[model samples]
Target: MAGFLLWLLLLVFCWPLALLALVLYPIVWLLLLPLRLVGITVSAVFAFLGALLMLPARMLRGRPV
Candidate 1:
């Protein structure tokens, strides 16, 4: 992919920094994992609230004969 190509370019141009990034990537992802989970949870909660708010209107709309 583009990222791998970019990293390969970096490795050719500067191995040390590229290695540092390679090593740090997992640590950075681990640190950000909780934040990603929180974002997903927040989105789900908002969706549930939206559905709850719409329930009454949907109920009253009823089905056509």
Candidate 2:
């Protein structure tokens, strides 16, 4: 029950773009997937690096940590 509610909230908040993804899935898979995959991978790598850089600031604040 609690897990389901948590998962629902997570899905709602994290996947707000899911509907758009669903609509675009076929088109993306058929046409854009290969082209976009490289960009996606690069973007993910940059985002990860950005998050890693921010981790020190977050930890130093001692807020959540």
Model 1 per-residue lDDT tens digits across residues 1-65: 99999999999999999999999999999999999999999999999999999998898889564
lDDT of each: 0.98, 0.79
Worst 10-residue lDDT window for candidate 2 reads: 16-25
Candidate 1 TM-score versus the reference = 0.94
So what's the TM-score on candidate 2? 0.44
| Tens-digit per-residue lDDT, 13-61, candidate 2 | 8776555655676886879777788899999999999999999898889
TM-score to true structure, per model? 0.94, 0.44
Best by lDDT: 1
Q: Residue 49, candidate 2: how far off, in angstroms?
A: 0.2
